[model samples]
Target: MAYHSFLVEPISCHAWNKDRTQIAICPNNH
Candidate 1:
């Protein structure tokens, strides 16, 4: 599978919206 990087920070977790049209991510910077 091919993945894309939209965030510059390392992501700890991610979630997609109900329609899967948007995303929410938690970065490991904190």
Candidate 2:
């Protein structure tokens, strides 16, 4: 099996695509 990880800033909100192959996030800085 394989896995993945990400490093990001504090997020206020997030969403995923229908297929879940992509993602979107809104940082709290704004």
Candidate 3:
């Protein structure tokens, strides 16, 4: 597993086709 440093206020994914965006987040201590 890899930990990435994301500095954005919130990481968001946008879909142009009206589909839902996908994201993975750590749940326990994230």
The true-structure Cα RMSD of candidate 3 reads 10.2
| TM-score of each model, paired residue for residue | 0.44, 0.41, 0.20
Worst 10 residues of 2 by lDDT: 1-10
Better of 1 and 2 by lDDT: 1
- Expressed as tens digits, the lDDT of each residue in 1-30 for candidate 1 is 113564544445766679867767665532
Task: Report RMSD (Å) for each prediction in the order shown.
Answer: 5.5, 5.4, 10.2
Question: Which residue runs does candidate 3 get wrong by more than 4 Å?
Answer: 1-20
What tens digits encode model 2's per-residue C-alpha lDDT throughout 1-30?
111432354334546569866667665534
Q: Which candidate is the best by TM-score?
A: 1
User: Which regions of candidate 2 are displaced past 4 Å?
Assistant: 1-12
The alpha-carbon deviation from the true structure for residue 25 of candidate 1, after best TM-score superposition, in angstroms, is 0.6
Model 3 TM-score, all chains together: 0.20
The top-ranked prediction according to lDDT is: 1
For model 2, what is the alpha-carbon lDDT of residue 9?
41
For model 3, name the residue pairs that clash: none
Instruction: State candidate 1's TM-score.
Output: 0.44
